[model samples]
Target: MPVPSPYALLLSNVMVREASVSVLDSSTSYWDYGPPNADTVVVAVHGFRGEHHGLDPVVAHLSGIRVISPDLPGFGESEPLRDLTHDIAGYTAWLRAFIEALGLHAPVILGHSFGSIVVSAAVAGGVEASKVILVNPIAAPALSGPNGFLSRLTLLYYRAGRALPPKLGGALLSNWLIVRFMSLLLAQSPDRDLRRWVHDQHHTYFSRYATRDSVVEGFEASISADVSQFAPSITAPTLLIGADRDPITTVDAQRRLVELFPDARLEIIPAVGHLIHYEKPREAASAIVEFLGDGAVAVSEAAA
Candidate 1:
């Protein structure tokens, strides 16, 4: 089977419009899809180093829901924060502002990888969301265990890379060869089409450096995060999706996350890695739509 383009798949389902919203001193770039007056409104947050388009695959599978995927500050077309760490607290504040600025009312917040941490923090910090969905939430220390040594080493390399001159550091961190190798190593899916699609995405989006400070700070923040303190305070219903084969955020960690939330359920996606949405968009979307309950509309007209 031929690899299907994620971008093409996304555009076929819903018309994506480029828009910008002012958040504090900076602005955020986002893609607005689906009907504006749809019954369900989903604000999807992409992972670290990911732009708004990163969630296109998942968005393609959703129907009758307004999906707003944003390129968080310092990524894609968004501007970086002037003097703030791209840490959980910082991102949580930004997310809160973004939601309020757009007048979202009890919308479902969906986050993948690093975005999961942001969503968790936002809810914990009292952002009013009807529900929260976390895909491959980072487990921090568990991510640095025996099976995660390579990832830890990579983080260290990023730290070193950040110390270099701007141009050299950007070039070193966004090297195409390195990005492709990392994508291959991280991909756990056996499907050739999905793997090829992931590789192509990495080549197109991952092998570029637009914000060095955000990359460095985001890496540090992810490693140092411990959401256990406030995760239990979240009042919104939560869905935690864990990839069984994920090397970075282990399934064990996701279970712990489930424990932290008062009203949260865990769903494990078998045989996939951290990039669950990229590898198994349909499955991920099904899990999310199911979790959303009666309010979610089924994808009756999806792109093949």
Candidate 2:
């Protein structure tokens, strides 16, 4: 049996708390893990079609420092922005405002998949962060990825969902089979149990968007921007946790993308695709713990 992760914190534990904060006139629901008093705070952003719960696997492998994972506007329990387009600019602004609202002081910022683009843009555009971490970061355009053809089909899927009437659109967007199919293609876990869990996760939470517009617009936004655009401006040291078999950006692309940053290191987990959080979360967490240094342990100790 695989060893239990060292920095591990179980998701089922009662220690995980739910909290909320108002940002941009909307209530953002978040999951708080680790000690509330832990000085190092890492605000995590979930991927497209994902809520805070999606990062539970990776977060479970991390402790000592507090992690705040919010459901992006319109996903999970969060409401959509009052009057902003759901584009990169809107998300970038929301993330910055969200952090400020929480009174975080240069907390480490982490993002996964679609979230990576948002965090990268926010950090590059001047939302302060002590450090940066990108999991399965999108290095290239979605339409130009290794799974370019499938991505194009997915673009069509989103467009179709938007064009159809509300009931039909929501039905199509929330189709369980499609979710499982997409999950299968991207979830490269060889372990059957892990694969089943990933499929279950997608089935349970992947299509929980508040509105058809939110899902469609978010999909468009996700494919529209990538970390490459913000890499050069992110002055803080960054870590990119990549996968050798990632269906979207290849490890080669990840390598090239890391070089563009002023200070960034790439960690490529083998035998996994985009779902590093599922297939190889232990490795991802190990890389992050090392990048963060002693769990930012000094902060809590100093405060004490």
Candidate number of the best lDDT = 2
Worst 10 residues of 2 by lDDT: 295-304
How many clashes does the backbone of model 1 have? 0
Clash counts per candidate, in order, are 0, 0
- Please provide TM-scores, in order, for all candidate models, with all chains considered together: 0.91, 0.92
The TM-score that candidate 2 achieves is 0.92
Clashing pairs in 1: none
For candidate 1, give the lDDT of residue 209.
33
Q: Give the per-residue lDDT of model 2 (tens digit) for 34-81.
A: 888986789999999999877877777676778999999999999888
Cα deviation of 102 in candidate 1 (Å)? 0.6
Q: Candidate 2's C-alpha lDDT?
A: 0.85
